[model samples]
Target: MELTVERGDLTTVAADAIVNAANSSLLGGGGVDGAIHAAAGPRLLAACRELRRTTLPDGLPVGDAVATPGFDLPAPWVIHTVGPNRHAGETDPGLLASCFARSLDVAADLRARTVAFPAVSAGVYGWAADDVARAAVAAVRSWDDENPAALDEVRFVLFNDVLLEAFDAALVAA
Candidate 1:
């Protein structure tokens, strides 16, 4: 697996799959979730509406990710993942790390070599960007060690230069 850090729009990554930092409901909301939905158009919402009330682990709160055509974005599929809420402490870090791990798991299962991730839990969820970057890089590194060929490339798409700097520092330290 290859690791990369970048500042880009998750809605515009031209990869096999892009992960959406979703709410527990899996319904469309603001930040990355809203951007993905808007880019994928109405069909994405229609598809997600069919999957209401999907369940996962108690603390994790992720739903079974559903694939949709990236109607407007460059990616072929969009993967929706619900991360833990803010104020969750180290417990939140665990759950957020799981979000990246599970998203990559799904991508590998689908034979996707490349995937893109937004800064999960850093938007409306209020997770510290630095912490999220550390947890995400750790999770990806661990996952890569276990499944060396599972991912050929992974990009951390930061929306702003500050976040880019944060991820860059974290990656260097990782």
Candidate 2:
């Protein structure tokens, strides 16, 4: 898969699927979560609630992922993953990494050719953006090795310039 760092609106991406960094509840919150909720409209929220009601295993908490319609975004689907909030320390780091892994796993299952992801848990969750950038790239690389052509294009979609730079640097280093 091809990986690139870019600063753009996630709602505008033309990928097959977009990964949303969401809270555990999957109910709307600030940062990227809020942006996605607003752009996807009410239907996305209802869809999330319905999915939550049945799909997820009980007491699983965050660090898991679920897929649903993109609602108002250009993409056909949205894969929502609940990232660690950084309070759980190194264990949280692995949980954060799982968010990326799980999202790509879903993309592979869905036969998605393109997927866009925001820096998971970097903003409101408070993980250093640069560090999370490296973790994200690593997770994608690991998943890509197993899935092969699951995704021809994977974008690290950053909303801000600083995040873009950090992701770019991490990807280049990788």
Candidate 3:
């Protein structure tokens, strides 16, 4: 799979699937989660609510992922994964890495060719940007190695220059 990093709005990226850095609640909180929900319109929230009523009554766990129709967003699907909250003492790097891995797994299961991801856990969740970048790059690379041809492209759609640079450097280092 091809990997690319760019400073852009994840909500506007044209891809088969977009990953939402969602809180466990999935009802839509701040950062990328709120933005995605807003962009996708109220149907996204309804879908999440239905999921909560049916499959995920206790909310999604950190490092696990689930999908919903993208609604009004550009993508066809939205893969929601909760990243570990470092400030809450959930400091395992593996948990952070699992966000990316599980999201990709969900995307592959949907047969999505192109996926766009925000910097999961880097913003508001309190993880260091470089750490997030490294973990994300490594996870995607490892998944691609194991599941070759499952995806055509994986784009890191960062919100700012710092994240874009961090992901670009991580991609180079990987």
Top-scoring candidate (TM-score):
3
The sequence of per-residue lDDT tens digits that candidate 2 reaches over residues 46-160 is 9888876887525225677878899888998999998887765534667878999999888878888999999888877778988899899998998889778778999988999
Could you tell which candidate, 2 or 3, scores higher by lDDT?
3
Query: On a 0 to 1 TM-score scale, where does candidate 3 land against the true structure?
Result: 0.99
Best-performing candidate as measured by lDDT: 3
- TM-score-based ranking: 3, 2, 1
Worst 10 residues of 2 by lDDT: 55-64
Give, for candidate 3, the lowest lDDT window spanning 10 residues.
120-129
Cα error, candidate 1, residue 122 (Å):
0.6
- Superpose all Cα atoms of candidate 3 onto the true structure and report the RMSD in Å to 1 decimal: 0.5
Cα lDDT tens digits, model 1, 1-174, are 778999878887889999988876666899889989998889787767656634432322553354555666788778778776675443447788888888888888788889999888886677778988898899899989999877799999989987788889889999
Number of backbone-clashing residue pairs for each candidate, in the order shown: 0, 0, 0
Q: Score each candidate by Cα lDDT.
A: 0.80, 0.85, 0.96
Residue pairs with clashing backbones, model 1: none
Q: Rank the candidates by lDDT, best first.
A: 3, 2, 1
**Lowest-sum lDDT 10-residue window in model 1:** 55-64
